[model samples]
Target chain A: MDLLLQLTINGLSMGSIYLLLGISWGLIFAVTRTFHFAHGATFVVAAYSAYFFQQLGFSLILAAVGSVLAAVLFGMAVEGILYRYLRKAFASHLVVFVAAIGTLITVENLIAMGFGTDVKTLEGFPIKVIKIGKVGFNNLHVVMFATAGILFFLLMLYLHRTKTGKALRAVISNPEMAEVIGIDTRKYFLLAFALGSLLVAPAAFLVTIERGATIDLGHWAILYAFMPVIIGGIGSLPGAALAGLIIGLAESIGIWKISSQWQVGIAFVVLVAVMILKPTGLFGFRVYRGKI
Target chain B: MILEVKNLVGGYQNKRVLHGLSFSMGDGEVVGTIGHNGAGKTTLLKSLFGLLPPWEGQILFRSHDITGRKPDSNVKEGIAYMPQGQGLFPDLTVMENLEISCFGLDRKTLKKRSQQVFELFPILEERKRQRAGTLSGGEQRMMSVGLTLMHEPTLMFLDEPSLGLAPRIVQLVMENIIEINRRFKNSILLVEQNFEQVKRVAGKIIVIKLGQIVFSGILDPALDKRELWKYF
Candidate 1:
């Protein structure tokens, strides 16, 4: 029972990271209707940017801010420069998706060429463990959980309270109606990219601190990012977050009886089960036309 | 003239829907367009509002050559379009929907405009906090019209405001459209299928057939309604 408790605690911390990744990808997909596979590249860029900034003797917090800004610029560039051109060319969804995959591969290759395919770690965060009853977790775990909770709260607040956020919701609900009301759908698409990139920065930074960063982290990051979205539902943000937690918990608990190497496979099993049982995802409604 | 279209030609990607359609409207006049399902009535509104770009045409709004401009630019030029269905966002609250309609307005202006909408449709005010999707069909229609009123537009392109409502609700919606024109003196280009309702509000009527205007004239009250069937 104590061991189960420990795994559950660990799963929650890991789930927070997945939650960040899922919502970042989900928001972009929901608003722009673009399958941005290159979001993985955005994750790697943010992690590397933080590492690069810290090597320049910047404070940890400043390095994080710099990373977020870099991620935002890179994400916006993907939408503003690449995606905008494709859209103007009237590219189909499949074509845009293929372009995104090509971009991910090209960027990953460039990073590998520049930094080599080795693990890189970000330092400065103190490693300390805290014990709660029979369960134990590190300071980083607490930070991850708190950060995800706070950010989620802030995101919901922004969506409900701010004008720009409401405009994004409008686009998500009905792009045609949104345009008819004079909302600049293009501007909102760029904004979705920006915010999506910003949300992933903390996840990248946290993971780099916990397990170090690698050139190939992007591929796995994107896979995990998409797993939650697909398991949750296509257009539901809360659904993605919940699915992230479920996947994290399932993977963590599965390691009790099986090898830890099979942890990744556990997520796939959950995804398949969800797909088979509920094709629209756990929280997905049948007529998911305009609810976010 | 408040608006004029000269030899407008447009459609969706190779399937030409509007073929050399030309018309003009005066300030503060309500013009109704009627047609069969594929007669390009909605296409006309889309082309004029820039949802569908005109392939070859000159759109003159208050004597300005605004051709192929996007919807945002058209909205800034005081043109508002209410799409065919429930134009309001279903997930958003009534107040949120209204807030998004006049997106760039100041808080004071937003408050004033919202107050005006509430006055026009008092039920909207009562249901301001309710989710727009949960509203009855009639209430949703009212909210759709209320959204167009948010920016106090000089020109409105309303596509089928009475599309899926009961008979009594259709009467109420037509009456509201008349009220909107009378109160704002706004030039309205209304596209509707129900000719009986159109006769209640429109001073002029244009009949479209397969993307071309078959008849354009005044809606003479003394004329037999059955005679209009020839154009359809």
Candidate 2:
């Protein structure tokens, strides 16, 4: 029916944003094994940075590029300054987890201090709607889909075809063995964090442009991002994207059939179902470390 | 001397495995370290290659102290380590495994080295696209040895190359090691439990027992296997 078509279009558009968030989280998690809860903070930082630059008389595209670059630098800084020292000190997983949570709180507070605690809006995004048979498409949605599609293609190419990308995969596969093979796993870790942060940049800007910015946006970003990754495999980028789309579709349909209040809960319902059925997500495999 | 480990002491947290172990190897020398399961042979190799840094004494490579350098730095300095259990990225393909071994090399060199690997082990060529995890046990061993050669290291540490392979495959692996040593002129430190394999490939033999070198000398065919068994 017409309703189904409309829901599907909305789902796909939402899927594009969720896919970026999932991939960004998955990248850093897969490489560094840091459950990077602070990604939520970085998401806010990037959006706010974009908003700041745009307000500074820069073009939207230039602002977006600058924001993404800033996010990457922030990601690297987090790893180098916080996580690296903890790892060197042989900190336990719980300690590292607590540290990550601490980082999230610190960054979130900083954002509120710099940008106001109140929700802020981003203007100037031209909203031109196009009508299909029974569904409508906005220019922003189309742009979101196109950007997601193009970036996904490029990411796949980078992961499978490039040397540094393969090095990242190697580190993810067996970090200790990767070291024995002369791979500087640290460099690959930085690359993963940077790439992951970079992937989220456009999504941050687009979301701000579409829905406006809020202090709570980063917190919601983590939830939206992590659910897809958990539903997919933790380290599988393709699965994360696929799961993102599935969650988005489910949310759209659920909102239409049920109530709008349950829209966010739909993704979690799917996540719980997936956790019970397939614990490793869709594409997770055991990473082989050498036996002693 | 290419490598000299002087009174080196190292182990896991609180459990010292190498208790003042000392040994030295010259260029192009294939030193065989043979020991029982708990004799710390693997630990010794791990310490030398920087997997576990020595707690005491010095590790001199080309007269420079590389006592506790990181494993990646050691590899870059011409030392390659292939640990037991065929330390490989099992999910990656044979080509991927070879490529990752010499990461950061130019595409042309990567391709050329891959070709050379195929030539060294033609079976690897046939399974270039196959996931390394799914390969047969013998094939996995071959791929492990082949990977270390990708970087063209001047010094190599092979931990238990013949640990879990058929007699036929063991022969093939030993042959490959001998050929690699001759061709690359690499100083090799081979740790293995199989005394027969050790005697076959190593000109100098060192026996480790309870984290210490009990014996060090040239391979003597006249020496009874029972005599070495007693030490282990």
Candidate 3:
């Protein structure tokens, strides 16, 4: 029973991290339809940026703000320089997909070159443990859970209550008509990329604080980020977050019950099963149907 | 004049659909362009609204050059366009559909503007919270037109407003358009395949065939000439 409780707490903490990653991926994918595989690179780059900035004697909060802003600028640069031209050239979705994959490879190599191939760690934060019954959670887990909760709440409010967010949805719903209705499709595309990067920044910071920063983690980051989106439904942000938690829990509990060697395979199994059973995902509605 | 196009030539890719098509309209005028399918009516409207860049010639709005400008810029200049078929964000609610148009407006002004749209179409007000996709065809058409009205554009371009609608709903849309023209004092360039309906609302009429204007005159003069029916 104590082992089960410990595992459950661990799963919830892991779930918060996955939720952040999945929501970020979901935002960019929902609005831009870019399938931005380089999102993982953005995550790790942010982590490294925060680390290096903190090493330069900046405070942790200031370092986080600066690094997140840098990440956002980088994401926008990718959109402005690469994706925008690809779209203007009327490139096929397949071509864009290949280009994004190429970008992911290039960014990962750049990070590895700049930050070194070794894992870099942040200075230890004041560690405080909170225990409930037989389960225990560290301060890092509490912060991760709190940040994820606050961000998700704010995101939902933005989507439902704000005009610009609604315009973003409008673009997602119908691009051509959105333009006709006078929404700047290009501007919103940039916003979508920026928002996705913004969501990733804190999670990147959290990872560095908890474990450490590694360049190659992007490979696993993409899977953790994308699986929730695929399982939750492609265009649904809340669904992605929920699916992230589910995948996190499954991976943690499943690994405990089975062998730890099969940890990575849990996400793959859930993804395949969801695709076969309910392709639209748990909360996805048909978007951009038929002709204009 | 509200808008003038001189020898405009453009089309998708290398296919030049509109060849030297020229026309002009004065302020507060409701002009209609009538033609058969594949006659370039939709293409002409798309060009005028800056969705398609003109290969040649110039477009002047309020005596300023606007050739090849983007659709959003045209909207800022008080021009709104509604494309053919169901050109709406079906996933949005009626209120969201209306609110998106008034994006440039401030919060208080947006609230006031929404109330005005609700007054224009009471049914929209009643279904403000419902998803636009679930609405009936006529209701969707109303929401589409209402979306244009939210910005209160001075020049409106409507492409096939009556397409795929019941006759009764068509009549309702036409009536609402006339009301919109009267209340807003907006200059309208309406494109439609329905010659009879165009004849009812259009003070002036232009006819296009194979991307060129074959006729441009008052509706009565063109209607009196039975041979002109062939162009329509």
Report the lDDT tens digits of candidate 1 across residue range A1-292. 9999999988888999999999899899989889999999999999999988998999889999999999999999999999999998889999999999999889889988988888888889999999888788899999999998888788888987899989999998888989998998999999999999999999999999999989888898899888998899987888888898888899999999999999999999999999999998877774345356
Candidate 3 residue spans exceeding 4 A from truth: A287-292, B221-229
Interface RMSD of each: 1.0, 3.6, 3.1
Which order, best to worst by TM-score? 1, 2, 3
- Residue B29 accuracy (lDDT) in model 1: 96
Q: What DockQ does each candidate score versus the true complex, computed on alpha carbons? A: 0.79, 0.57, 0.57
Residues A201-226 of candidate 3 have per-residue lDDT tens digits of 88888988888888877777888888
Can you write out model 2's per-residue Cα lDDT over B91-141, one digit (the tens) per residue?
688888898898868879888888888888999999989988889998999
Compared with the true structure, all predictions reach lDDT values of: 0.91, 0.86, 0.86
Docking class of 1: medium
Best by TM-score: 1
Give DockQ: model 2: 0.57
Instruction: Report the Cα lDDT for residue B75, model 1.
Output: 88
The model with the greatest lDDT is 1
After superposition, candidate 1 runs with Cα above 4 Å error:
A286-290
Q: Pick the candidate with the highest DockQ.
A: 1
Instruction: For candidate 1, list the clashing residue pairs, or say none.
Output: none
